[model samples]
Target: MKKDRITTINKTAETIETDLLVYFAVEAKGKMPECDTAVHSQVKKAFELKDFSGKAAEQILFYPPARSKIAAARVLVLGTGPVNKEKDKGAALDMLREVGGEVAKVCASVKARDVVVCLPPPKHLSPALTDPEISAGALAEGIILGDYRFEKYKESTRKKTDYPGLDEIKFVCKDNLKIVHQGVEKAKNAAFAACTARDMANEPGNHWTSADFAAYAKQLAADTGLGYRCLEKKEMEQMGMGGILAVNQGSYVPARMVVLEYLPENRTETILLVGKGLTFDSGGISIKPSAGMEEMKYDMCGGAAVMCAMQAVALEKPDVGVVAIVPATDNMSGSRALHPGDIISHYNGVTSEVVNTDAEGRLILADALAWGIEHFKPACVLDAATLTGAVIIGLGHHYTGLVSNNNALAKAVEAAGSLAGEPVWRLPLNKNYEKQIESDVADIKNTGGKPAGTITAAAYLSKFVGKTPWAHLDIAGTAWEFTKKAYIPKGPSGTATRTFINLVRNWKPGKIK
Candidate 1:
């Protein structure tokens, strides 16, 4: 872990000395001094030179000190593609990580002990498709993430080589260092929570069960000052939580409903956050093929993000009341497994016909959302879930799909996503999509066929919201990535946790105008 602080250009450069000065090259163009001197001809010519454009390849150029001139020990220039085409915040941030990782590799190759990254002035850069703060935050985040090394299990490898660890990092910025620092701390905290969630979610099913997750939630509440409660199987049955009970029938581990609340001082409005906690999704009696069953471990990422977001909120003490509800269980196949066409009564007294056991996320979320509405009476509600592959097919892994009834609430979430550097794209929630979830056999159906699967899932959960301004974030595609990009790692991205925290921290009632 490295500690970083931003210093201005007005500050003395002698305050810190390093082995290299890395500069960002936009469209193969390097920065040049403004002075008109004959000896500067070489530097000017170098700036005018162009390099071949590659898909995502980076080109590094080193400039050594000239005679009698003590230039930086070394100058490393990084290519960032054509400036106009690379202005997308997410893409630009990804480039920064690639560049940073290359720098780290070069430093290790030469055994250089220290390095400093010049955070360029924001004025020199064009506005990213996302907000400016997010771009800056993503840059900082990428540097940190690029330096991550999972060497804990390295002892088993026989290959021997020297890989120097990064000791410190210094960020160079002109203004808003405090605000940037705040964002940095928020990102770090969110990352830590995500790592914890990933570890829990990635554990083997035998090791991590619904009961185990419930106990961990209780422990988190005890360690922190957040309120916590766990509802047992009998309690859920007593409360008419048939959705959870049906999902848990096949698993030996009992279903547990965990609720954690953070009440802020002088709070004016409350927000409810519901997360789908399918600890392991076996597709139940509608068992999925074995090809991608390994990915089932990540099914609980939605619950993890919710838990992590609440943890971050408690740590930051945002000025808004929040209730995080997680319905923890596993969807497995056994003699007791739920069969298609089974009618289950939910907590809100709405009956759902189980059309497909694989569509279990919405089933559990229904109970959690109803619990939030009936208990917290929040002004607004937001739920995140790895609900559908249809979402991934629609939006890919780049953005989380957002569906909401209230335009204001949806926009707020989108803005929060921007500020947190976790982007979201809103999807429509038209009445035609809502009608897809309607059931002829029961009050509603758990699966709405294939068309608009993501929207139908949102609509199904919306039934339990009970007039509260609500939004649904389907993060099935973004919650986890197979490859590293920008600030996110190859595993759990901690997708919407920071966005939710930002939304609550900056929330103001009736401020939409």
Candidate 2:
């Protein structure tokens, strides 16, 4: 992890000890913050020249003369657009995050190692968000996320600059020391969990295998006091998990089911998180096109998210009992690989006629969902998977496809996704779609048809959920992509880790009635 050392300081940026100083200046209205005469002169000169108006996404870079009173050499002023609306609250808060990411990109380009960020009190902003904690948290998220660079495969990271990427980031939040620390701590924990997920997702399929996932689960359990178990190929076969066995028959790496549980004393509700753990999806005998086949390593992002979410749950120690199940394997097209129209009898005796070998995520997920519900009897089940490209066609990259059986659970899932900056748009779960997956010789078909493909995929998983209030988050569109947008690099986004963590942390029982 190339993350910077994050700290909170009550002192102003001018007097802070760092290589660069960062400031927040609102668009068209922000007054220059109190600083030394030289810094003041620089700001005034920029305002006079009109070269650096405080517009949204705008930045002004200045270098103070040598031997100045301020300890910083370079100063970066970030622009925040007008933020006054109550309804656009999410957008406003996100602007702060955007500004933080912008500053981080600048610092990364310059290869600066340390910097001090000063959050100026914007007079035009609402008073409710004037609290130091909220702003500090948002900025920390951007700085940490933007500073990310998955350069592990690079031969050398050594550069000509004095330092590489950021090593330290000090946030000056004045007298609000306690709240600022609290916010920064929370952000740091969330970022740590999410970035860990990203790292796992970005790993090549060969490097991060089913056994590797089991190892990570054991480490997490050991570190966080969570109960962990790894059901190897023998155990899974003994338990009659046909879906997992069928998928792994093509791979030499073997299959494993990683189960992580965080139980608190006298917990009222249990929530099960099932993630599809296909480390690599080659579409089995029904092979995908050779193009873009390398990117199939991201097929395990769902498992990565669940693994990281369980880790976060352990750290937060939420009152609700949380159990995460990831049935991991690599789907390859060897001679013995599963062929089209194969019948897979899942853990719960639900047989699926696999029309397309590429639709393997739901097959593995069915086993975990069935086992998780029956063995744990969780109050609710939320299974996330990069299930289908139809979801990407429908929701694009901005939103995840959410389908659920119960209205109350659906509402809660949507709220959790929204709070975590991973919003989900609800799709219908009516019984009407169930018929699309009806099979001739099996209990159901792996895929329904071309029309409403996302809904039909959820319909197939719904069969194994039993009586639990279940929600399916098809994160196919949002998990990993090559697009470079703002703070998000061209790789895995750690899609649902924070949302799952938020759901567990804020979960309250008996409210669904």
TM-score for each of the candidates = 0.82, 0.94
Give the C-alpha miss distance for residue 207 in model 1, angstroms: 4.0
Q: Which candidate gets the maximum TM-score versus the true structure?
A: 2
What is the C-alpha lDDT profile of model 1 across 1-513, one tens digit per residue?
Answer: 534332223232323456665555444333442221312444355555633232123444455555524245665554455443555554555555455556665555555556566554554344563343544555555555555544443566735565645565555555666665565565556555655666666666676677777877788888889999888999998899999999999988889998898976788778888888888898999999999788787788788878878777778777778889889999999899999999999999999999999999999999999887888888898999999999999999988999987989998998888655578899988778878988998999987789988888888988888678899999999888733553455666767776787788778976532
Cα lDDT over the full model 1: 0.72
Model 2 misses residue 265 by how many Å? Answer: 1.3
Alpha-carbon shift of residue 445 in model 2 (angstroms):
0.8
Worst 10 residues of 2 by lDDT: 30-39
Report the lDDT tens digits of candidate 2 across residue range 406-477: 899888887777656678999997778999999998989898889999999999998998678999999989
In candidate 2, the residue pairs with backbone N, CA or C atoms under 3 Å apart (3 or more residues apart, or in different chains) clash, namely none
How does candidate 1 fare on TM-score?
A: 0.82
Stretches of candidate 1 exceeding 4 Å from the true structure: 2-21, 25-75, 80-115, 127-136, 148-155, 158-167, 173-180, 194-202, 482-484, 511-513
Residue 458 in model 2: lDDT: 93
> In model 2, which regions exceed 4 Å deviation?
1-4, 29-40, 84-86, 122-131, 156-164, 482-484
